[model samples]
Target chain A: MLEGISYTDTKKLTAIIKERFNLDFSNYAMSSFRHRVSVAISKFNLVSADSLIEKLLNDSYMFDLFLKEVSIYTTEMFRDPSAWKYISETVLPKLASQNEKINIWLPECTSGEDIYTIAIILKELGLTQKSNITASFISNSLMTSFSQGYEIKKMELNKSNYLRFNEKNDFSEYYSISNYKAFMNSDLLKNVSIEKFLIAPMINPTMVNLIIYRNKLIFFNSILQFDVLTMLTNSLECGGFLFIGAKENIINPEMRKHYKVISEHERIYKRISKN
Target chain B: MKNKIILIGGSAGSFSVVTQILTELPKNFRIPIVLCLHRLKHVRSGFAEALSLKSSNPVIEPYDKDRIEEGKIYIAPANYHLYIEAHKHFALSTEDSINHSRPSIDVTFVSTASVYKENVIAIILSGANNDGAYGIKRVKDLGGITIVQNPEECQVSTMPVSSIRIMKPDFILSSTEIIKYLIDINNKAFFGK
Candidate 1:
């Protein structure tokens, strides 16, 4: 079955972006990208992607908007509490007990929600001092937001989610309100590093203990998803854990061999071997 | 395309109508049927169970990424938008609501139009909003048979009226005529222009 004729226009539009801009979206699902480009086109009041692409190439501002449209920017803290609870209870404890300093990386930590959530988890578990957390994203637009220090936009929703995750204390203890934006406490940033990364064609700093890559895989097609998984696998040392979104699962039959299931329901898998 | 898949979407005053259809679709029916209804976001596991007791064919909320199977009825779960993959599987997303609906009618209808094209039969019934209007148009454009319940007979008229305005639907019948058409649609598929 083919995407409607306009979607064919969408494919040609993305091809132009990929070739001229050298941005690799070869991995994104066609259906997903078509829907995204359609939305972008609708925003510009353009009937076709052909018109949208012509504008994007000429106007840098349009390009930024295009980038924003393509990437799903969700600034959710502890979006799924059960997955967080599983990580806090089962995965983090083992890493904390192994060594004083645990090297944790969030490859697609869009905005700072993921990293800040982990920081709070470490603080509660008394592993804040012994954790070196690194967060990275492919999108420069989102990276700029992350570099400006963590700001919780949906403070009430985050508060509600945090309360549901663990209700022992007020979730507000983790952040201080400044200029109507919730800024994470300075203490949690002591052992953290944030950077923009190109995880696809290149990768660095192998030997990460755990990689939190939830839900981001849905943005890519199966081929890219498998390729990214393979890259993340090489980036981690033996026995390192890989956590995905609640709905995200290792689907490629051949890709399933490298990792062993930690929790099928949570979509958490552990690297069985470094190779 | 094997036996054609039937997709039904509705919002206000559709629960009883859906239950009636679900109860009538036979156990050995070769085709798979999927239903997307707009309901309260907090509902997780109740609607499917309620429908299952009266349904002749088994009815259950589809798990995210579950493979589609014939002879069963799949309901879009609450709070998340539903999508069908080209690989004939379901993928759920928490993307923001469209037309104030999460399991959005347009979202699923357009995707199904893209994937299944002529192999689908889609029906829009008794919704108070215009969620499924665009979807019905897409299905019609993609060469699938599109049906809208008669607005005069429906408890709510906004949905069918919107779709009917956008599309000269192949059939605009009451619930009884629609049910009878669905029961025989597999063997006597809608092929007329």
Candidate 2:
């Protein structure tokens, strides 16, 4: 029985997970992954990482639970008010004026917050009719849950953030209250194309005009971050905009040249180069 | 000793202690310092700036995956738990808050102690909660030196007192003594003594 997962055990378990689930967590930041693996072991009443690996190999259902456990879903609608404010005030309007059909990609959509926020903003701006939104998730359960609607538990924080982002509109107008739960208006997601898209090398580039891939890259190691950024860059057309989390950046010198800063504090960048 | 990293953790009533230490340290101090102090989550912009105003060296809130370097002070950013990677880079996480704190002192201390082992120098200062107690205990178990702020000198004795209850720290010093001890270590490194 181990007290916690060691760094060596982390490598062994990640390898097993890759072979079993066809998911590559080897490229994840090791410390956080190790922490999550320990949490999983304790949560399942397992004694060690080795036991966790045994259960993972034998049971497919266990993998699904584990996927949800380790994956981060820490998102609130309009969590960072400034980023949403910048999008509403500047980025969206510019894209609306320039393009006939504005293509936006929210890849590996963990929580439904980003999707709803984008949808609400698009509708408010009267750009919904002309926008194409692609929201991707890695698993079907996640998609099902997202369709259910944003949790009422987070409604307090969500409302506060919305007020900070735009005080003109009522935050409550975007969702309906039933059974003490706030179900987002269905029309908000009517135009969204939901699909399963893994975070890996891209075969078919969607070539989107704006990508709000926030706070996702920090989970990946430098090598994996570079690869994912490359895929996002390819999927994004030149002169298109990219929005990452405030603490994330284009660390690779090669990738850095492709995007120019539009808002330094908000971490919004415009794809400036084709190559 | 030259390769060691200093990790200081505190929550409530720690700002003044930290500022004093930073103000007293020489510009040529050799070891890198990592600080994990609890602060307001939504108000993200000013903590580093406030610390940098009086520090001898630059105070930085590093981006995720930024390389950790010597002689500078690195602070854990708001709303994220900070971890020090084995390769000496910073990793940030949006996982659920531990001990009701995102940049939980325990997370940074444990990660650094695990990575650096005997080379880590861990300190716990004044705080209202017992967040750093388990972390300081982990550091001691991993052969890193552990220190607690003297309870009598603390603005809030709960933090150091909690740490002392669990295990014996190597030292229990007042804020002034803590500064002197660090300066002594810095002098030894400078003179190759």
lDDT of 2: 0.87
Worst 10 residues of 1 chain B by lDDT: B184-193
Candidate 2 lDDT over B95-161, as tens digits, reads 8888888899999988888889988889999999988888889999999989899999889889899
Chain B TM-score of every predicted model: 0.95, 0.97
Residue runs of model 2 more than 4 Å from their true location after superposition: A1-4, A203-205
For candidate 1, report its TM-score: 0.85
Q: Tell me the deviation in Å of residue A63 in model 2.
A: 1.0
Q: Can you write out model 2's per-residue Cα lDDT over A43-129, one digit (the tens) per residue?
A: 999988899889988887999999888889856788788888899889999999999999999988877888889999999899998
